[model samples]
Structure formats: structure tokens, C-alpha cells
Target chain A: MHILVVEDEPKVAQAIKNGLLSEGYRVTTVHTGEEGFFQAASQKVDLILLDLMLPGKSGIEILNALRELGKDTPVLILTAKDTIEDRVLGLDSGADDYLVKPFAFPELLARIRALTRRGRSDQVLKLKLADLELDCITRKVKRNGYDIPLTSKEYELLEYLMRHQGHAVSREMLAHDVWQVKDRATPLDNVIDVHINRLRSKIDTNFDQPLLHTIRGIGFIMKTEDEP
Target chain B: MKLVLSFRTQLMLLNTLLVILIYAVAAFFIYAFMKNRIESVELEKLQEQVSTVSTVVYKSGGDYNDWYHLGDQKPFLIMEDWKVSYQTTAWKDLNFPDKLTPGDFNNKSLKTYSAEQHNYLVKINFVRTGIDTMHNFQVVVAMENTEALESVEKLARSLVLGIPLILILAVAGSFFLSNHAMGPVKLLRIKAQQISAQSLSLRLPVINARDDIGQLTIVFNDLLTRLEYTFEQLKRFTADASHEFRTPLTSIRSTGQVALKNAGNVNDFKDAVASMLEDTDRLANLIHDLLQLTRHDAGRLKIDFSKEDLVSHINSVIEELKILAEEKGITISFLHPDTIRLHINPAYFKQAIRNILHNAIKYTPGSGLIEIQLRQEESGIIRIDIKDNGPGIPPDLREKVFERFFRIDNARSASVGGSGLGLAIAKQGIEINNGNIKFVDSNRGATCRMVFPANSAQDDSSAI
Candidate 1:
């Protein structure tokens, strides 16, 4: 999937661009409203991360212009203005979603994932890796064709990881997306570790190969050993 | 030093003065009229008596005895051949002139004389008895005029007593009337005094809408309403400003705390520092914009105006902002006449234009088209219009968008990162240059128009 980031602040734009790139998505970053508008109108991207205030053009103007031109690219408004009127106006201006500034990066990624998932034609109800299988509709998991009981939080964390399978998932991402915690200041890494340890003991203890791999100092990755 | 009196006191004094003047004039005229009437009546009575006495003597054929027995007791003497031939007993007691002079014998010759310390009216006349005898008699008649004098004195006494009484009544009545008239004004003053900054909602009482005082109260109430509204708006503005500042500070604190708590690695510390730096930059920008607004409000934002080619100046600003526009893949096109010179504060003028252009670029989509046009019209106005293919501001918000801290999309504006002072500052800058800026009607995109008087450029230069 390809995403375009339209932000005027160099650091913010770079951070979002880097975050999306590390998630195995093609990302393009632009600093001005005009450039954002140009790339959005001319290029094909799965999603557009739009900033409201830009040097040349505003994010809302770009969203409106693109919509006026009949472009249906999903737009997520990222702005510092968090008033109710601002949110309503942004969504009413044809934005698919709105996120306030100082938002958790994991939350942004989750919203992006949700928006991109809706645009795809193929819908998968079941996820499988090695002997571990999760039936999304039934809320059930099976390991080596045997029922593997899992807690709700563990199941949710597993589901998010499987959605971005074979990619590195940061502890902050897991805490924000899986735990639904917005405050980044909360010390949730230990909790996330405890949950991950429990889930690992349940599925990988009796299996020959472990599917979950930790990328030291960065985050965690879920992939089979032979894939590398 | 001039004496300053309250309106009520002045009004009362004026009413008293007018009443006294009218009374004094009326008394003087009445006294003069009464004196004239009383004097004339007394003289006529004395003359009638003298004529009656002379007729009785002439009819008796020079016999004075019959005249004395006529029963008119008024003092009279008829002398013939230098003798007091006919005199009443009362006439002998009066010190009358024994030899009547010819001047005294003239008809209707009246004089004021005193008898027994009483005022009397006397008249002397000459009478001829019979044509055959050719006898001339000098008759003098005197009647008491004390009654007429007493009547005049009575009138004078009444006037002297009544004038002060009437003046006192008029003064008291005027004081009451003035107090009644100014009662509403006093009420208004009391109500106005009760209204403080905290109690601005209070309003003066309007007792009678048609009266002057009532109308003044109504006007004062209207002013209070406006003041209350302004005060409320100021309060809201202060709250919003503090909130704006607090949000970033909170974010910086949160980010730093989290980073420090999880600082097991150098990269974690680096990430925390970076986020803190971004927050600080945002804070600094906000403070800068606030300072500019404060200076503008204080009338300390100085603008040194001089004659300059506006076209070149605008061109340079466009050049400076083009790179920013190019970053978004936006195109900016400028069209103007060969040269348009106007008196303007170059820095401020450029800042205003830059703000507008920046807004257009910020709002327009990438690869959007921005068109700027400048022209000098026959009306001596230099008009500049900047049009962009962006979502135009809503019609309702066109005027409000210029207000301080006004953002159309608060949430969107936050993430986009702006101090919300760009347009407000732009407006101030333009006004300082004696120019006006407004949103023009456009079919597709937002168009902003600015106008400056070209003639003033020459006027300013000549004055310098």
C-alpha cells in the first residue's frame, strides 16, 4: 500500500513518513499544501495523511479540491486544532477520518490500517501462521489443529500483529492499538510484555518453531523462521 | 472662579427669579394706577363743592347768611370787596389766605392743604353774582383727602406684604417641581453606580420613556449592554488563548516524562528530545504571534511608509515563497501591469501579502493553481487579487476568519500547526499602510482582494 504525507513541519512529516515506511508501506512526504495537492491529484496512493496548515495550501482546501475533482482517495486529517467544530468541518469537508496533533503514532497507524482495509476487495475472516490459526468471525484460535484457549486481550494483540504480519511491531504500537491507550506517557511496555509472554507460552511452548521474534531495542516481529 | 451648580439647583433658582421679576413689575404698575385714580377723584369733589357754594351766594343777591345755612360743612369762604362775607365756622379755624390772590381765584385752582394735621384737597375759583350789579366773588372750597391717601397706603402695605410671601411660595413650588423632574435622573445615577465590572449586567431604570431623563437612562442601558458583551468576549478570548498555550505545554511534559521513564537506550532519549524541541518551537511561534498582536493593539507597531514600486515588491515576495509552493508541487502565477507605484511600509506591506499567499498555498491542494493579479484602476485604487483553486472559506466565516485566534477547523489547524494570528496580523499590516483587504466572490476557489489608494502615495511623498 502507498501513503502520502502532506505536512509543513519538517520533523513531523519525516516522523510520519518514517513510521509508515517501516510498516512496509510505500510513503511519500511533502512539506507544502501545493505539493501535497499535486501529489494527491496526480499520483495514485492508497491513503493521504493531510495536515491542515501548510505553507502553500491548507489541508482542508486540498481535501475539498481533490474531492471536487472526484478523487476518492482516503484522507486522514492530522492537525493541532482539536475543537469539535474543527473535527466536524474536517469530516464534513470529505475527510475519511480526523486525528488531533500529539497523537500516538500507533493510533495513527491503526486508523490508517482500518481505512485501507475498507478499500480492499478481498476480505479475510481467518488468519493462519504455521500451526496457529485464528478464526476472526468465531473468535477462536487453534494450534496444530488443537483448540488453543487465549484471553481476549491476547487475542486482540494477536489479531493486530497478524494483520501486519511479517513486519516489526513496536511496543508502543501494541500498547496504543491493542490496549486502546492514547496516553503515550503510560508505562505499558511491561504489561504488553506480560501478555506477549502468556500468549507465547500458550502457542509456542508445545510447537517446534516459534512464530514470534523480538527485534532487540526496536520492537517485535511475527514470522516463521524459514521466511528469512 | 465660576460657581458650579447642580442642574436641579440651577433650574429652581431660574424659576424663582422669573416669578419675582413678574410680581415686582405688576406691583409697581398697580401702585401707579391707584395713586392717579385717587388724586383725580379728590380734586373733582373739591371743585364741585366750590361751584355749589358760589351758586347759592349768587342766587341770594349778595346775601351771605343763606349760603352759610346751606348745610354743606366743607370749609369755604366767599369774599367780596376784600371781606370774608361768607365762611363756615370750620373755615374760621383753618388758616386760609385772607386776601385771595387772582391766581387762587382761577377755575379749578386746587391745592393740597393741611387742617388739624389731616390732608385735604382745596379748590379756589372766581364767580360773578349778577350782570346788573357786576359783583365778582372769589370762592375757595376744601375737602378732606385723607380717605384717598389712606386707600393708597392700604394698597402699598398689601403689596409690600404680598411680594415676599408670593416669592417664598414660588421658590418652594419651583424646588418641588425641579425635584420631581430630576427624580428619574437620580434613580438612573444610583443604578449606574451599582454597576461595576462584575455587575455589568445591571441597567439604569427608565421610568418615563418620553421624558429626557428616561431617554438618557435608556441610552445608558444600551451602553451597558454593549460593555457586558465586550467583557464577555474578552473573557472568552483570554480563556482560549491560555488553552492554546497549555495544550502544547502539556504535550511536551507528557512526551518528556514518558521518554525519561523508558530511557534504557540512547535512541529513546533522542526521540524524547526531538519531540520536546518541536513543542518548544510551537510555543515560541505562539509567543511571537502574541507579541506582534499586543504591539499592534498598543499602537507601537511602527510603519515607515515610502514610495515604492509595488509590482517589484510583490514579485520579490512571490519569489521568496515560490520554493515553499514548489515543495507542495503548487504553481503560483502573477499578472500585473508594467509598473504600479504606491506609498506603503515595504516590510509591513510585504508581510501582509506574504500572509495571504501563505494561506492560499496552505489551503490549496498540491499541484493546485494560484493566480495573483494586480492593477491600477481609474479611481486611483491599486487592487490586488489572489485566487487559488482551493476549497473556499464558507460565506458565513468570511468576515469572522479575520478575528484573532479564529480557526475554521480547530482540530485540523492544530495538526497543521499554526498560531492563528496570520490573517489578523495581515489585516493590521494592511490597515497601517492605508489599505483594505476582503474576500471576493469567486465561482470555484477562494479569492482575496486588497486595495490601496495610489493617489495617497504622491501626497505622502510631497508632504515628506
Candidate 2:
């Protein structure tokens, strides 16, 4: 997928470009709002990652100008301001999604994947990684043809991790998506760690290979091979 | 010209003007009355002289020499048979212009005349010295009233002269009275000037609490007290925030420096980076919490209240944190009714209850028991108690723990991985929801008691 990034900060813009390039996506970057608008109007990018505070023309003004020309390309807004009104205004101005500043890289990747997969009807009910399998319908888990008993919270945690098996998921993503915690300051870090340890012990304690892994300093990841 | 007068000066000027107005009115009435009294008395004296002169002439048998002694002291004119028969020597110089006849006495027996700028009171009388009509004679008595009018002029001069003295006395009296009345206010001003921001604890002396100025001083002192308290809290908050910020930065710096000097392989370097990353995450959370608190203090956060099932909401919070407690072999028991609806901001209420529950799980040891009780009192207050069989907080530090960055065991808090702002944020959220949270004495462990008033805990399902 081709993504257009409009950001004035050089370091942030470069980091985004490198991250997205390594993830096997085409990236186009611009510094000023005027150049961003020009490139967006001329190019055929699949998605646009626009920053709210640009030098020449504001992100809101450009979004208005683009929408007025009837371009419906998906746009995700990145902003330093995280107030409720700013989020509402961004969405009202035809933004497809919004990410607050200082957001985690894994959280950003998750939002991008969700935004790009907006209209797809692909749903996976059963998830597998080598010997472990999860049945979303029955809310059951099994490994090596034996039933694995898990608590309700553990089931939810395992299903979320298995859905995005290969990618590392940050604690912030789990806190928001799985735990449904809205406040970023809630002291749920230790709780997430304990639950992860229990889930690891329960599934991998009696197995020859462990499917769940911790990427230390980052978050938890599920994979077939043992690697950091 | 606009003269900006002080309050005392204005009072003095008003008093002086009032006194002058009263004195002027009295002086005018008295001057008029004295003039009228003197003039009427002079006319009566002239009438008495006329009767005496007529009697003397009646006894003398119409002879001028016999009554001439009475005329010697004043002026007199005698007319017999309608002709001027006798005139006093003094009466001749008086310049009497008109001759007196019985016709002049027809309507009045007295006349007043002014000649040569001298005033006179004249009385005319007709006397019968014999039985025949020819023996009848008319006597005219005239007196100069210059001295009577002179007495009246003297009285007016004296009255007019007294005005300047009264004015001087009124100004001085009013000035002294205003100064005495404003003495307390002047003292208040001098004392108030001595108070400054550095010395906010100083109070304005109340000279008389029953008076207006004293009451104003008391009110100002009350305001200063509140300001001083808020100022002190701000100073402490700044110091604590700086310390919190430095704690994580210190760890990160030390870890980085050690890694650079001692790392022999990429794994060692990676381990150091990981540890530093953890510290940075902690710092980020601290900054986020501080921002949330500042927003709450500024009254910038919007609250949307709705009716929710309190039992289910709290049950869910406990459920969410049950795994953490279970991981430590701790057990939590929640005792509540099947349903208890309340008006509250769910997000804020959840944040508060979640933080309190998290603190309990963190402090409670392995195999410890945490009990949550929810019930409504008879006084229409909804109370929730979260008790844990852990080391309890001392009574002295119960209220202090709500302060920002306050910890019961400072050294042990670091290992607990708490940002030290949990209870502060919890207090703010609970206050916004019209609830109060405090620690109550329990026989075992710590008990956090939260209460909501009747109005806040009301069940109004139809209204949002």
C-alpha cells in the first residue's frame, strides 16, 4: 500500500517513513501543508497520514480543501492535542482516524491495519500458531489435541494476541483494546504483566515449544519460533 | 473644578454647610422681630405723651404758658378755632410742613411723618376748655423717633457681626468631629499597608468588630488566609513534581552510563536499553497524570453524568483486577446488593474505584484477603468500603496520603511500580462526582471508605 505522510518535524517524519518502509509499504513524505496538499491531489496514494500542525496551510484547511474536491481517500490524522473536541473536529473534517502524539509504535501499526482493513469482510473465527488453536465461537483453547482450561480474562488476552500473532503488541494496545481502559494513566501495567505471566505458565509449562513470548522492554508477541 | 475630597473632608464640608443654613435662618427671623417690637413701643410712647399734654392744656383754661413746660421737653403745636395759635421753639425748627386740623384727626388720632430724613410719631387731640364751642382747642404732640430706629440698626449690626464667628466655630467643630470619627479607618489603612505577600499570615487589626471598617478588615484577612494556604500547596506541589521527574531521569542516566562503560556484548547493551525504556515509560505516565490533574484543577474536563447500575459497575472493576490479585494468591470478596442505581459519571467513578482497588491489590500480601462492602445508610448516604488485610496506614497519615506524590513507605513504593499520583487522581475524580473518600480505622488492615450524598446517589432512570 502507498501512504502519504505530511509532517513538519523532520525526525518524526523520517522515523515514520523508515518504519513503514520496513513494513513493506510505499511511503511519500512532505514537510509543508502546501506541498502536502499538492502531492496528495496529484498522487494516487491508498492512505494519507496527515499532521494537524503544518507551517503553510493547516491540516484542517487542507482536509477541507481536499474533501471539497470530492476525494474520499482514507486519511488518518496525527495530532499533539488529544482533547475530545480536537478528535471530534478531525473526524468531522473527513478524517478517517486519529492518533495522539507520543503514541506507541505498535499501537500506531494496529490503528493503521484497522483503518486499511475498513471495508474487508474477512473474519477468522479459529486462530492457530503451530500446535495451539483457539475457537472464537466456543471461547475455547486447546494445545496438542488436549483442552486447555483458561479464565475469561486469559481467554480474551490469548485471542487478542493470537489475532495479531506475528506483530509485537504493546501494553497500551492491550490496555485499551482488551481491558477497555480509556484513561492512559491507569495503573494497569503490573496487572497486564501478571496476567501475561499466568497465561504463559498455563500454556507453555507443559509443552515442548512455547507459542507465547515476551519481547522484553516492548510487549508480548506470539510466534512459532523462539526469538526476541 | 472637580476637587477630589477625601471622605473625612466631605463629611466636614457637609456639616459646615448645614450649620450655616440653620444660623442664617435664625438670624433673619430675630432681626425682623426686633425691628417690629421697637417700632410698636415707640408709637405707644408717643400716644401716652399726647394724653398728658392734652390734660395739661385742659386744666390751664386754654393758656399756652401753663402747658409750655410739657412742650419744652418735646415739640408741640396748638391750634385754636382752626388757626395755629401757639408753636414751640423746638417745633419751629422741626419744619412741620402741614398745619393740623380736626379734619386730620377724623380718621386717626396719630400720624407718622418723615421730614429732612428724620422720622417722627405725631398724635393729635381736641380738648374743650369751656362749655362754649369757641373754647375748644386741638393739641398736636410730635416726637422724633430717630433714637428708636438707631437702636434697631444697632441690633441688626450685632446680628450680622455674629455670623463670621459662627462660621469659624462650625468649620472647626466639624473638622474635629470628622477627624475623631475617621481615626479607626486611618489606623486600619496604616496596618493594612504593612501586610505583604510574603507575610500573608499577618492579619489586619480589628479595632471595633461591630463597625464597618473593622468588618472589612476581617473579611480581607479571611481572603488572605485562603490565599496563603493555596500558595503553600502550590509550592509543595512544584517541589514534589520536580523530584518525581528527576527520579526516573536519574535511573535512566545511570543505566545508560553504566551500559556504555561496561557492556561487552550486544545483549548487555540491549538489556540496558530495555531498562532505560522502562524508566522512560514510567516518566511518560507521570507526565500524563500530571496533565490530567492540571486539567481537572482548571475545570477544563467535561463531565457527563448518567444513571448506572453501581453494583454491576463496581463488580466489573473488581473482576478486571481479580487476575492480579489471584496472581499473588490473594482473594477478594465483594458484598453488595443485586442492584443499586445511581447518578454518576461512569468514567470518573470507574477511574476512582479502579485506582483504589489497584492500590489494595498492590499493598496486600500473598494469601491476603480484600473485602468490598457496598450499602446505603439510613441517612440517605451511599457508602462503599474496601478493606484489605494488609499493613494499615497510621491515623496521622490518612489524610496526607491524598496529597500529590505522597507515599506511606517511600522506599517500598518504587518497587510497587506506582507513579505516586494514583490516590491524588482518585481523589479528584471522586470529588468531581460529588463523592468523598477517606480512610477509616479498622480492626485489621486498611479500610478505604467512600460515601456519596443523597442527591448524588439518587436513582433517576428517566433523566440523563
Candidate 3:
């Protein structure tokens, strides 16, 4: 996949380009709105990470110009303006997704995956990692022929963790996705921590090979021993 | 030219005009009355003289000289058979009328006649001679009234002459009175101009508290007091915000520097990076909370209120925080009879309840009890009480705990890990939803009491 990053600040543009490249995607970075508009209009890119604030011509003008020409590339807006009106304007101007600044890298990656994967996601009833097995239809979990009892909250947390098996999921993503909290300032870190601790003890306590592991300062990840 | 008059000048001019109008009408009436009195007195004397002359002429048997010897100084004329039969010597030089009409003699009428540039009072009478009605003659008596008219003119002259003096005095008096009345206003204006934002504590002097100007000054001083209070609050908020923001940044900076300096093993370096990242998360949360508060202060939040079941809302909040409470072995008991509907913004209301519940769980010890009671008061006010078996807040510090960045024990709160804006946000959220929250006295621990009106429309927080 090919991606284009249009950001004015050199350091932020370079950082995004490096991060996208490390994930095995061809990355192109542009520093001005004039050049960004040219590249987006002509270049063959699958997804575009466009910043709203830029020098010379603004990001909105570029987005408008490109959209007026019927370029159907999926545009993800990265902006510092998070007011309701700003979000509506970006979406109304044909932005596929909106992410606020100072965002977590894991959340960004998750959004990227959701956007690029679009209609290709297929439903699977059973998920497994090493001896652990979860049945999506029955809402049941088993490891090495032993059934595990989990609370409703524990079940939901484990399911989300298992869906993003190898990627580390930040607390903000869990708070928003699982708890459905729209306000980012809510102090739900402790609650998430407690639920994760319980889920960990239940799933990995009786087995020699632990599938769920903490990524220290980041968050939780579910993977077998040899994955990383 | 369009003339704009000062208030005091307008008052003076109006007063002076009123005085002049009243004085001119009074002088005109008094002059008319005096002139009339002088003319009436002259006419009465003329009639009496005419009677005396007729008697004299009759007694003397038609001898005009005998009546003339009575020494009447005024002019006289007699007409008989429609001809001037006799005339006084003075009457000839006075240019008296040639004839006295017989019609006027029938009633012995008196009339004013003007001849030779002088006004006269003329009295005509018909008298019988020697008791014979056939021998009757008409007597006409005339008096020169130019001197009397002149005296009245003199009186009018004096009256007219007094006007300018009276007008001068009226204008001066009005100006003096208006200047005296407006003296305090001038002083007030000068004092008010001297006060600025830096001197908001300065008060305008109240000359008389019961008067209009004094009342206005008092109201203005009250406005200044409120402005000063708001200014102080803003200053403190700025200082506290900067301090809160600095602490996390300081930790992040120091941790990053120390990690780079050590250059230790891979795992050790990873631990340092993780510590720094933790501080970064703290900073980010603080910034987000600050933005929310500022947005609320700017009145930018779009709040839509609707009727919802209060019991179910609280149940959901409790359910969300149940795991955290259970992890510490704390038991939460909700005591409510049935569903109670209320008008509120569900999002803000739920956040407030969640914050308060989280606080209870954080403060209570292991195996402690937390009770939430929901009921309607007798006055139709819906009340909710959240009480926990933790250390109770003191009476003096109850209100202070809701202030931003206020923690009972800073060291312990730091260790417990919160941005210190939870309670502040909770209070604001409740207030914006038209409810009141306060820490009431409890025997075992802190009891938070929140009350909402039975029915209220969307309320603006700025009003409170």
C-alpha cells in the first residue's frame, strides 16, 4: 500500500513518514499545501493523511480542490481543531476519518487499519492462539479442553484484546471502543487496569505458556511467545 | 443651529421663563384695575356736580351766572330746546361738544368723550324748573380726565420699569440654585473618571444614600466589587493552571534527561522511557481537562436536555464503576424505590455521577460500604446522596474541596494518581444541569448531597 502525509511541520511530517514506512507501506511526505495539492491530484496513493493547518494554501482548500475534481482517494483528516463544528466541516468536505492531534500511535494505527481494510474484513466464528480458543458465536472461551468462567466485562475486554491480537492497544482506545466513552478526560484508567488484571489471571494463570502480556508503559497485547 | 443645553442650564432657563410670564400677567391686570378706578371716581364726582348746578339754576330762575358763581372748576354746558343755551367760559376753550343729545338726557346718562386731545366724563340730565314739567332744560357737565389718565399712566410706567430688574433677579436666583444642586454630580463625575481596572476597589462617595444620585453610586460600587472578585478568581486560576501543567512537564523532562545520561542496558533504558511516557500521559490528560473547562467557561458547549429515567442512569454509572470498586472489596448499595424521571442532559449528568462514584471507591478502605440513596423531598425536589465509609471532610474544607487542583493530602493524592480535576468537573457538570451539589455532614464519612428541581427547563450556567 502507498500513503501520502501532508503536514507543514518538518519534524511531524518526518515522524509520520518513518512510522508508516516501518509498517511496510510506501510513504511520501510533502511540506506545503501547494505541493500537497499537486501530489494528491496526480499521484497514485491508496490513503492520505492530511493536516488541516498548512502554509500558503490551507488543507481545506486542497481537499476541496481535489474532491471537486472527483479524486476518490480516502482522506483521513489530522487536525488540532477538535470543536464539533470543525469536525463536521472536515467530514462534510469529504474526509473519510478525523483524528485529533496529540493522538496515541496505537489508536492512529488502528484507525488506519480500519480505513484501509474497508470491505475486505471477513467474519470468523472461532479465534485461537496457542492453547487458548474463543468461540464468537457462543461467547465461550476454552484453553486446552478447560472451560474458563469470565465476567461480562472480562469477556468483552478479552474479546477486544484478542481481535487486535499482536498490536498493543492503548487505554484510550479501550476506554473509547469498549466503554463507549465519548469524553476523553474521564479517569477510567484504573477500572481498565483492574479488568485487565482479572482477565490476565483467568486466561494465563494455569498455563505454562502465557499468551496475554503487558507492554509496560503502553498497554496490553495478546500473542504467543514467539510472535514478537 | 441645533442647540443642546446642559441639564442645569435647561432648568435655569425654564425657571426664569416661568417667572417672567407670571409677573407680566399680574402687572397688566393691576394696571388695568387702577386705570378703571381713577376713571370711575372722576365720573361719580361729575354726576354730583351736575345735580348741584341744576339745583342752582332752578333756584335762580334760569340765571346761569348764579350757578356759575358756585365756583365749579370743571367745564359745563346747558342745552334747551335742542340748542346750546348756556356754556361756562372754561367749556369754550375745552372744545366741548356742540350738543347733548335729547336721547341721552332721558336717562341722565354719563359717557366718556374725547375732544381736543383730552378725555372727558360727560353727564347729561333733564331737570324741571319751578315744579313745572313743561319748563324743563338739559344740563350737561364735563370733567377733564387727562390728569387722572396721566396718573394711571405713571403707575403703569413704574410697573413696566420693574420687569427687567425682576427678570435679572430671577435668572440669577435660578442659576445659583441649579449650580448648588449639581455641585455633587460634578464631583461624582470627576471621581468616577479617576477609577480604572487597577483601582476597581475604589468606591464612589455617596453624598446622600436616600437620593437618586447616591443610589446610582451605590449600584456602581457594587458592580466594581463583583468585577474585582472575578479578576481575582481569574488570576488564581491562571496561576494554578500553570503550576499543574509544569509538574508533569518537569517530570517528563528530567526522566528523559536521566535516561539519556545513563545509557544503561536495554531493559533499564526501556524502563526509563516508560516512566517518561507515563508523565506524558498525565500531561495530556491535564491539557484535555483544562480545555473542557475553558470551553465551558466560554459557553461553547452545546447542551441538549431531555426527560430521562434517573434511576436507570445512576444504575448504569454504578455498573460502569462496579469492577473498580469490587477489585478493592468495597460494596456499593443503591437504595431507590422506582424509576424517577428528570429533565437533564444525560451525558453531563452521567459524567458527574461517575466521577463522584469513582471518588468514593478510591477513598473507601477494603470491605467498606458505600450507599447511594435516591428520593424525592417533600418540597418536590429530587435529592441524591452518595455516602462512603472513608475519612470525612472537615466542615471548613467542605466547599474548598470542589476547587480545581484541591486535594486533601497532596502526597497521598499524587500516589493515588488523578489529575485533581475530577471533583471540580463534577461540580460544574451538576451545576450546568440545574442541580446543586455539596458535601453534607456525615457521622461515618463524607456524604455528597445533590438536589434538582422537580421540573426545570434548560438553564444557563452563567446565570448562577
Lowest summed lDDT across 10 adjacent residues in model 2 chain B is found at B455-464
Number of the top DockQ candidate:
3
Q: After superposition, how far is residue B42 of candidate 1 from its true place, in Å?
A: 3.7
Q: lDDT by residue for model 1 over A53-125, one digit each (tens)?
A: 8877788889999999999999999988765568899999999998877665655877888799885664779
| Per-model TM against the reference | 0.59, 0.82, 0.86
For candidate 2, write residues B1-464 as lDDT tens digits. 98899999999999999999999999899989989999889878887887887888788887667866774557888788768877888778788876666666677887877788898888888888953434678888889998898899998899889889999999999999999889888987887788887787888888788888778888988998999999889889999899999998999999999999996799989899889878878887888888888887898777788888889999888888888898889999999888877788888888899899999988999999999999988877888999998998999999999999999987897788777889998898788878899999999999999998887666564332
Mind listing the fnat for each candidate?
0.00, 0.56, 0.53
* Candidate 1 chain A, poorest ten consecutive residues by summed lDDT: A181-190
lDDT of 1 by residue, B74-177 (tens): 67777776466777766766777666666564544767777666887777767777646777777777788888899999999999899889989999999999
Q: Candidates sorted by lDDT, descending order?
A: 2, 3, 1
Candidate 3 on B79-175: residue-level lDDT in tens? 6666787777777767755655666546647777787679887787777675444456777788878899889989999999989998999999999
How many Å off is the CA of B137 in candidate 1? Answer: 6.7
Per-prediction DockQ scores?
0.01, 0.59, 0.61
lDDT value for candidate 2? 0.87
Scoring only chain A, what TM-score does candidate 1 earn? 0.75
Query: Model 1, stretches more than 4 Å misplaced?
Result: A1-228, B1-10, B44-71, B77-86, B89-110, B115-117, B123-139, B199-202, B207-210, B264-271, B300-303, B453-464
State the TM-score, rounded to 2 decimals, of chain A in model 3.
0.95
